[model samples]
Target chain A: MKNLNRRDFLKTAALGAAAATLGTKSAKASEKLLSEDRLGVLVDTSVCVGCRHCEWACRLAHNMPSPALDYYSNPTVLKEFRRPDKTALTVVNEFENDKNPNLPIHVKIQCMHCDHPACVSACIVGALTKNEDGSVVWDDGKCIGCRYCMVACQFQIPTYDYDVSIDPHIRKCDFCTERRKEGQLPACVNICPNEALVFGKRSEILRIAKNRTKRKPDIYINHIYGESEIGGTSWVYIAGKDFNELKMPPLGKNPAPGISEAIQHGIFAYFVPPVTLYALLGTIMWVTKRRNESADKDKHDHHSDSHDHHSDSGRDPYRTSGHNTYRDSGHNTYRDSGLSTDKDTKGDNL
Target chain B: MKPAPVKHRFFTPGVIILAVLALNGLIFLAVRFISGLGAVTNLDNNTPWGLWIGVDVAAGVALAAGGFTSAALGHVIHREHYHAIVRPALLTALLGYTFVAFAVCVDIGRFYYIWHPLIMWNGNSALFEVGICVMIYMTVLYIEFLPIVTEKFMGKVNLPGFLETFNEPADKLLRMLNSGLSKTMFIFIIAGVVLSTLHQSSLGTLMVIAGQKMHPLWQTPVLPLLFLLSAIAVGFPMIIFESLIASRSFKMKPEMKILSRLGSMVAPILGVYLAVKIGDMFISDDFKYILKFDVPAWMFMAETGLIIIAFVLFLSKETTRSPGRLFLASSLVIAGVLLNRINNFIVAYKPLYDPVAYFPSFGEISVTVGCIALLVLIYRAVVIYFPVISHK
Candidate 1:
């Protein structure tokens, strides 16, 4: 039975190693191979009417304690910009267009669901994963609540359930994965009165966004906010004013994990660097030991010769007139005492 | 070289104060577990990691690097003169790591699921690498300490009544284990050094993914290399600091000759760390950010200035030769590294949207202080009972 268990353990270990190697390779190779039919939403801020019905719908759909529908009509809430938190999955904030103050822009904030997510790469326990449908989702059961995802997120979208004492989780918008599976649009998209949010395949939405900007150059901004930012996002945006004016961060086109992973993997590839480092340390230890051993032998020989002469004169070698001679010969005595004692005890064992 | 315990009173006013602080920290921890981290800490979504991670984990790990450095010098390299300091260094490291793990348990929200990293691997995450390395290294450290435990108890396992029969068998088993372990200790030493290198650098990699969130002064591509170099630079100094403090407290003559040699080794490593840091900054054009006269700029200047001072002090033979001067220089290096870590993890990091500033609460500060005090107390207790300090 013991032999059988040992064999099983070895087999499992070997298989685990192989799986780990293959998993990293596939993850790297699939960086740009996003699903062709991945879902996305294009938000046209120019057309948004600033009514926060989407926030109410999101709360209602997610089983959160939302206020009465009449309460959301109060524009005073928009006066103070708010972020999506544990209580709310999505929020709408008002940004006054500097070029035209009369026409204010309403921006909806939630998880961007990047194609190459930093949170997915930062989660130490594989709790977060970038789904094929362009949604960055998390598994609560596997999450250790390290909150590294919060730090890794370029958009800074994920929030923690700090209020809950037991089984706290990281909360964020999951792109309404359940609604999509049921052939229904996201709660926010379905509730938009002006069809400000258009949902479809990412490529189709990008095409439509380009066509709209090309057809009416005066109506839309020249750039799409999430077309390439952080390796693209499921939620794209087009606004009349600059994205900065709408409170969107200006991010580079490259994926957020690109540089960090590059350096990390470069050094640890095939575990070559670690193995080589260990070998180098061992070699240094061997060389230093040989040199020290020879030096100790020379010192021992010289000490023994001095001891014979001192004995002939009938005086203690470790003691002088009215003082300890060992204390005066600092380095030599310190070394000889420790080294000779070690030799007497564990020398043969080494 | 057999070691004997120093004779000192077990209880003192200082120990009483530490016990009070520890009790207070325990109460706060109990509240934290019952109510949540929100009750005790100022950590929010904008600042998920605070003083616990910055000080307790990062600084703790860096200070514990003394164990590997001293072990390499004394055992693997066979520098017999360094043998006196190795055991104490190991004990400090063991206690430091134990508290670091405890701090992680407190800091993590799902403390029960802390073992998930072992089964569910995310090799791409730098944190994953750190977690695995730390776990394995901690185990190796414990195994390395087994010989000490065996040495303390072998042939002296005196048990009363029901447990008397087990003593002989236990002693025999320990003798077998000790003989076996002594032959293979070099492997663990090599493994310890390798693991330390991997994780020490990986700690810096944890911040690299922050990219724009981190201030330009600290965010560079060669952060892993810099972290590794600084950790190596601080290793010997940490040993010297601990050795001097331990000797003074125990009323023993400090091993000045060997310690001065160790002090001499710190200069070259510190010089290399400075060169790499400056070279990386210049190459990345991050020096431009230093001209802004902002908080991050001033912090950067302070951190670098402290290290430069330590480097210069260590270069002088007179400074390295004096125990008092050496202790001061080593303290500066420790403070510089500690500040660098805190700045990288907290001060220099600016979340994009959140406007609320974060400062650790009183509960947080007390818990960190209490953990350090508890570690010192444990170190004292272990050295007093076990033969950790070499006999004069």
Candidate 2:
């Protein structure tokens, strides 16, 4: 008995340790794929001319519908702030520069591709995944077009092909994944006339962003927009105007999925909670069934001794006996059923 | 002592209306599959989920929680008096889950890929947890309902004409299944309750990922707990309401004794839900949103107000004992839960670039109404043919 008791304690201790590990697994596993030398883009709104050349180049590269490159130069369209939609994978929006009224800040809007991407966490079918290269990519074959990614995105970058009935696609910026395979920069970076968009290793470009901000503190805001928002993003921004005024959503340092995943893991750690609940319910059912059975026996035998003799029997007899009581109680519980007509008629009047 | 099939005419003026409503829904449902969700639903890139998800799927799941709650009370607690409500509750859950699955299929862009979630699992996703648990629970519900089928046909497997030769064999199979299930049903019963707790809470976790998009009034870390508690609280009222309506429809005596007892237990559950909901609001300092009294605030008020009113009603002996008062109280809770789900999924979801506030399109409303009408029709049909409701 002592040996068995020791073994049981050891087993429970191991299980408890495993459950503790499981509780923290989600946060750790999600971070394991993040690489130090991951590619990223630095967007300097101070340098961007709002020429919209990157917009034309992005469309041409993506093989999506676009007019001539000259059509993008038409500044009239930039009058109204445009978001990156199904048609445009990236767009440059002009913001009012309060410091220098003549020179407006043209902030490019696209997928920030967070280090801890919420879309990847929220995707029901693992359709979206964050790559080691710092690009959050979507698989065509995997997407069910639920558009939960739209709801989860802090930037609201993903757009659905809603009008298309058959094989509707979830459209979003893929950070020029195809072009990068051929050792080329993103189309936006390639077409930037003023070097407003810088593409390089995330850590390296972050250093450059900090240097530029320190060198020209009067010109650029001290804070780098995406350095730590939602646990950092691939696209870092150095802008002259306030980021909040630029319509960049203010987010905390914690990842979008942090609190939610913590709760999820807590509830489902090694499935212990569920199994324990099941066993607890089973025990309650067993004990209560026996008590009810003994009560019923007491009623029938009209003797306390026989009721006590009914003992905690095996599963087979107890289950069958429980059903027998259920069958009998159908009448006793519904005793008012036979007399409910007049009362029900009155009840119906309400 | 045994439950027998209710003997009554199937159709009436109210039923005709329901049939027409269902027909209207089917037409719209067909339009959706053919023309795409954009053609029928008010959903766009900004607002992805609307009436179909909020009312049809979320509210449907919440309202159908009677199955596990009753099972817990009747079988697990061994309250033999409540066993009469179990079969009906099981049937309701089975049908409700079926409706939820169908709504999901319709809501998703690629309906054929619906089975992908079963194979392709994402542990990080709250939705994935909800999807998996709901799938397994549906299967468990079916296994639990098999006893009713075997009981109805075990000794009476009489086939007609050419099939008559196989009647004895069929009877034997039924008997075998009956014996096997009688021994094994307890496993499925406990499993159903466990799964219900898992997915019901995970359903709340679904909107937690929405973050800033969700109004602060409803958005909190404790949403899952609130959702689970609300689901349990609403469970008994749903059973009470269904029992009263079923009896009235069949022109039979309602099981007032059991229903009244069920009613007495409701106030405490609702109280727990209220305490948690209000407590979370105060602790999180989200009570400030409630003071705003804007549309979202009013919607929140309406949601909690219904539950608060129902809770007060349930606390009184006058309400629990009187069938009319109990019915009214139960309806309030059901409506409150329905509104709460809609508020959580639709009204509270304020996305960036929302040009206009989303309202359900006419097609969307028709489809939602049609599904409920169909569910009720099916419930009526099943109880008339099967021994679900107990009576003398």
Q: Give the poorly placed runs of model 1, Cα more than 4 Å off.
A: A1-28, A286-350
**Predicted structure 1: lDDT:** 0.81
Q: How would you encode candidate 2's per-residue C-alpha lDDT over A90-187 as one tens digit per residue?
A: 99898888898998889899999999999999999999999999999999989888888888898899988777678998888899999999988899
lDDT of 2 by residue, B312-338 (tens): 999999998888999999999999999
| Residue range with the least summed lDDT across 10 consecutive positions in model 1 chain B | B1-10
Q: Which ten-residue region of model 1 chain A has the weakest summed lDDT?
A: A308-317
Report residue A97 deviation for candidate 1 (angstroms).
2.6
Residue clash pairs of candidate 1 = none
For residue B132, model 1's alpha carbon misses the true position, in angstroms, by: 0.7
- Note the clash tally of each candidate: 0, 0
Q: Give the TM-score of candidate 2.
A: 0.91
